[model samples]
Target: MDTTMSADTVVLLTGGTSGIGRVAAERLAATGATVVAVGRDRERGRAVAEEATAESAGTVAFRRVDLADRSAVRDLAAAVDDEYGRLDALVHNAGLASATRRETADGVESTFAVNHLAPYLLTHDLIGALADTPGARVVVTASSVHRRGSLDFDDLGFSSGYDALDAYARSKLANVAFTLELAERLRASDRADGVVANCVHPGFVPSTGLYRDVSRRAKLLTRLAGLVPGVGTSAAKAARRLVEVTAAPEYGERTGLYVGGDGPEEPSEAARDPETRDRLWRVSADLVGVDPDWP
Candidate 1:
């Protein structure tokens, strides 16, 4: 870990209203980093940021954003650029676990839109600002459940059929693919030297609102899983791994890396598949109207 605090470094975190993002925002803010938290609920988002800033004795602020809207994400990026002049880190932590299939106003599936496309679009729009700062980091929160997800590009929007679990898993898988591919693309470009990208699985953190959409019985089962000696852990514990990944000195040279619970474990077979990663990058760029030139 760097163990060095710098107030000048700014971290923009999504889904800062609750759960892991909430804890992370506070911790980063406390470390003298300026934290700009993004969430849909204005009250909750502001409260979280305020609490974080209060606890850290550092700078923390909130911005209301429904990431599912592409234009909103663009505006948010513009606002960040204007306010901060540079974005040092971006944590794509916002996510949703919907019980039923729903579509956003943009005609994209809600799960895919919120979980994958929003972050993809946001990161792309802010890449210039991040590259402007040397030694900047991009940390994406992924999930171990990505192992179960097989990308079906033709039905990416869950158009033909949709299962909540499958859709969620696919979105998480997209996160991994996006992170890895982004790392590859950025590493080869002028941005490679300073702006590094990485992704992580925070482990099966229980009571993280990740199971809020599941049935009561399912929630009970998840609670039970965490209780099983060494199972689903606390969000605080999970956040440590994520925080360390972003701030650690050891990772300074390793970009496009997929990290697991115990340091840098190997990602799933699917996550490491170069072909799948490339294809997902193309499809995601097509969906978001960004150039697939990075591929």
Candidate 2:
């Protein structure tokens, strides 16, 4: 909790305009780390950046990027590389929960594209920047719902029988698998020393806009469910957890790990499978048009 980062340290955080990402951005900025907040809404992004800058000791900048668009994500990475030659942390927290199945311009499912592939591609594109920085970290916002999810490589996009919860859960599962595979690859690549990747389940946060696209009934149900004891945590608390994983010295050497409210916990059986992780990596790379053997 007392971890202090240098002012020169650069953090690229998606979904920083709102919810847990916003809180994390503010908290990290207070630690004197330069925070680059990415989001689709330029207005909100600018407002959050101003607020964070006013309240924090470090600098906070905003960047616009549509996570669902591969080209846009690539452009965002390019811009980040151009501005900051090295990155200290890459936090992926942007995601959506849709009531109905939808496809992106890339012809991939909207939920999968936004939640999983976007982070995969963005991380793949920024690996060099991260590798060059010592002790760089990758923190993915995943979910415990992954425990109830299953992946079918044959139909990863969920072209048929698309259930909202099932799609969201699968995407979360992919988040875990991606983290595991990314940790392994970073170890094998150049400048792997001190570079680590980990995922966190922020618990059920019903107050965020993540479920805005879901039906009213579903939204009501989630709000009701969140009222139960031990069911949900406030967005600020969840964001603090992310800040801990991102800046805490204790987790600096941890990789391919899953951390929840109680600390590091075991992911689902599928999330622990090497073969599944490899397959998911390859498929994700293919979907996003990135090289699987990226450095």
Candidate 3:
């Protein structure tokens, strides 16, 4: 942990109350940073903050939020900036999987709304704060399953057919594409030297609550998979991977990288395609009603 960096830094981490995110919160705070942890569960969020305060050189603060709501997302961004003024890292660790298709309060698909659109809009609203902080980063918790995803803009909501795993994979693909595009934009902008964006694949972590909304059979199968030898990722290990990307020096300069346990590597063909990345960024901005061009 970079105690000096952590002591001077401010990190906004969503889904900080659970799974790898929960562990990462404590770890990040231990590095001596003021970590603002966001999640819907007030108790868990507070508990994380309390634990981090007790165990680490740094500290954590909890905020309750429903990322599915656009207004709430905007308000959260506003509050973060109003309080912190500058942001060292914006970590999108929050995500979900749904067995059946549903729409958010904003009428966007629930899975896409929470996993992709929420972060997209939040980033747009916070890029200025990030640019003000030297060596700031945007760390997205993408997944390796993105290779199996199809980003069909016409069917983004999966109205034609919906599968929990497929929807989750697609959302992660969007995360990767968004990171790639955002990195390019940040690099070309006046704030290019300060802000960097990257995504990480934490591997198959069936131990997390991410699959809580999946079908019963899927849940049972996930549990069974967890019992298998070396099949499931431990929350502790995954959180370390997240911590590495969030605070490690190597990532401070690198942008558009998809980091995994092995380190930075190329992502799926679809994710690497400039056409797909640009289209996703533009479409995401339209869905969130933000300007396509940004830092």
Candidate 4:
């Protein structure tokens, strides 16, 4: 994955301070793009920025943000829009997994709030900025596990029961649905010159910290799986997959692709349904207090 971004390009990447995201941030920065790495840990975020800047000799700025807070997501978008004026790429790589059922400050499920709604609201706020830049792309980090998931608009919070793996998969399913829907809407928009939106299943990355919040049994399984020669995707490999989707020519030429282990592949049947996509868009908009009709 020796992909490169053009000089002066600006990319806003969520979850950029750690794990696969951190490596992706460095890789993007190495391409000469101003990579804005958003995360919750200020110290860790700043450290990554400093180290990546030193290693890549490129800019890697850090922004502390709690994606579960709707207000914070809004503020982050506003700040990025004001500072950059135009965004070349927006990557929704931040995700959440909780061992127990938890609600965010916005009264939404933690996993759903961070994994899905944050991207939904942030994209709503930044769509104008994205539209400002011709050829801008939106790449989301989804998972293949979404095939095992189902969405119940009435029960997005999983009020009936809670399982860490199940919740994560559900949120990932939303990621795919949102990416596909956004791409379609962008196509019809008059301003949709070259903006593309796609999601990639980064494969089963057992080595990433994404599963640290899962239950003991799940964590143990991930650890054991990581021991396999090639069962679990390394953070660096996963980052490469992310960068390919973000800056690759093929991805820019197309829209609404779901790339998994074998490059572009069909997502779950539920995710490809137009009705499901529309409903997810509307419900997500309602959840985040935004109008469903968007660019």
Candidate 5:
């Protein structure tokens, strides 16, 4: 990667135990940025950081965090603030794709809590540091599956009829909407002048552990898709794009854009709904116990 940040640039990435987050962490570290990876598995997290640190001229570390627990997530955010004192980027990449419905420690659905609320709390807490970084960026890893989503705030937990794929899609859709609204607020408040908050669909990359719970039938389908040349991209390639977008000056001062494999794409109808996005921001603030002010 040609892009290089200052030696002091601090990047905090979740879900770096594997997949795109792992690759992105390593790539950023090689570029001379401090990388702090967050995940629940101590062994895997340590291994990832060690490999990155070995390949990097910068510092690489790991912090165990389970985003499903609200209080735990809050504490992790506080720890990050205390340790780093400044955050240049936060990549919300950790997530779970469960075939069964699960609840978080805070009684919220696991998918919702991990995929959305976790980043919400973490980013909310780290806004001060992000704002301090002149060219800070927030990149959310959403998916094309989000196109198949519908927002039913009344049934946010999917109580009546819950399917794992649908729930995951809804969470991703919420990500795009959250990015849009958050970008708007950031620009309006002028807190993040050169900080651009954007979302991206990292196209299908097989063997990412996201399909760990998929049935045999799903696995077969994934294999078949991989057989096709352009159907699935590699984790490394996708992470390269992510790193580029996050570090590029072209994205500076721009916010709320939904980028795809082929560059920016039009977001889903639900994702573009300002009212719904605003409402989600408010609801997420309440869930995370943050004040109403979000920028």
Candidate 6:
């Protein structure tokens, strides 16, 4: 895959301060793309940008964004458009693994808000900028765990009962569903030729910051799992797949594809359900206060 980027190519990446996101940001920057790395921590964001810029041939800029807040996500989209005018690629790599259920300021489940709704809202807000840019791509960091997920629309926030793994898996499933629907929407729009959307499972990288909120026992188990062959991968290795899916010329025209370690793989039955995808899109749009049938 050709890793070089045009001088005008601009990529916006979330959760870029650590894990695969961080590694991918630096790698993309090294390929000469202008990378806007978004995160909630100001200091860590700045440090990641500085380190990536110092080591890469391209430019990396830090943008503070709290994915849990819908309003903040909207502001981020506007800022990106105002600053760059065009977004070549938008990589939704931010994720959360909560040990216990919590609610966001928006009165939504924290895991769902951060993992799924954030990307959904941000992409919706940036649709115009993305459509305006040629060969624009949307890359979401999903998970293989989505296969075990079951989405309960009536209790999306898990008001009745909540399990950390269940919540996380459901959110990952939402990511895949969202991408499938987004691809269809973009394809039906006038700018179909320019914009595309896809999601990927970056492989289980237990060493990443994603497990910080989990229990110590869970963390130890993940570490042990990582040591086993074919169980987990390093953040750096997983990040290469992210870059390939997000920026490589091979995947430029592909939309709604679920990429695993090797290449495009079939997603779970739930994720591939058209009705579920449409319902999730509508519900997500309503929650974020955007038109459900947006271009």
Q: Tell me the whole-model lDDT of each prediction, alpha carbons only.
A: 0.83, 0.91, 0.90, 0.90, 0.84, 0.91
lDDT of candidate 2 over 156-255, digit per residue (tens): 8888789899999999999999998888888887656468999999878889989889988999999999999988889999998899999999888889
- Candidate 3 lDDT by residue in tens digits, 73-189: 999999999998989999999999899999998888898999999999999999889988888889999999888998999989998888888888899999999899888888789
- Scored by Cα lDDT, where does model 3 land? 0.90
Off by over 4 Å in 2: 191-193
Candidate 1 lDDT, tens digit per residue, 1-295?
4633488888899987888888888888878999898988888887887777777857779999999888999899999988898877889989887878899888889989999999888888888888897777888999988888878878888889878889989999888888888888887886544778898899888878878997677678888898998787788988887777777777656788878887776777787789998898888788889997742
lDDT of 3 at 254: 82
Residues 1-295 of candidate 6: C-alpha lDDT, one tens digit per residue? 5853666789999999999999999999988889999998888889989998888878889998889988899999999999999999999999999988899998999999999999998888898899888889999999999999988999999899878889999999999999998898888887554798999999999889999998788888988998999898999999999999988888998899999988999999999999999999999988888889877
User: With candidate 4 superimposed using the best TM-score fit, by how many Å does residue 156's alpha carbon deviate from the native?
Assistant: 1.0
Model 2 CA lDDT for position 228: 96
Candidate 4 accuracy as TM-score: 0.97
TM-score, structure 2 vs. true: 0.97
Q: Candidate 2: minimum summed lDDT over ten consecutive residues — where? A: 186-195
TM-score of each: 0.95, 0.97, 0.97, 0.97, 0.96, 0.98
Stretches off by above 4 angstroms in model 4 are 1-4
lDDT of 2 at 56: 86
Off by over 4 Å in 1: 191-193
True-structure RMSD, every candidate = 1.6, 1.1, 1.3, 1.1, 1.4, 1.1
lDDT by residue for model 4 (104-170), tens: 9878999999999999999999999999897899999999988988899879899998888789889
Instruction: Tell me model 2's lDDT, rounded to 2 decimals.
Output: 0.91
TM-score of candidate 1 versus the correct structure, residues matched by position: 0.95
Off by over 4 Å in 5: none
How high a TM-score does candidate 6 get? 0.98
lDDT of 5 by residue, 1-295 (tens): 4554668888888998888888988888888989888889898898988888987887679989888988888788788888888888888888777788989868888898999889888888888888887778898988888899887889899989888888899899988889888888888876665567898888799868888876677778878898898899999998987887776666655778898978889999899989999889988888778886866
Backbone clashes in model 2, listed as residue pairs: none
lDDT of 6 at 133: 86
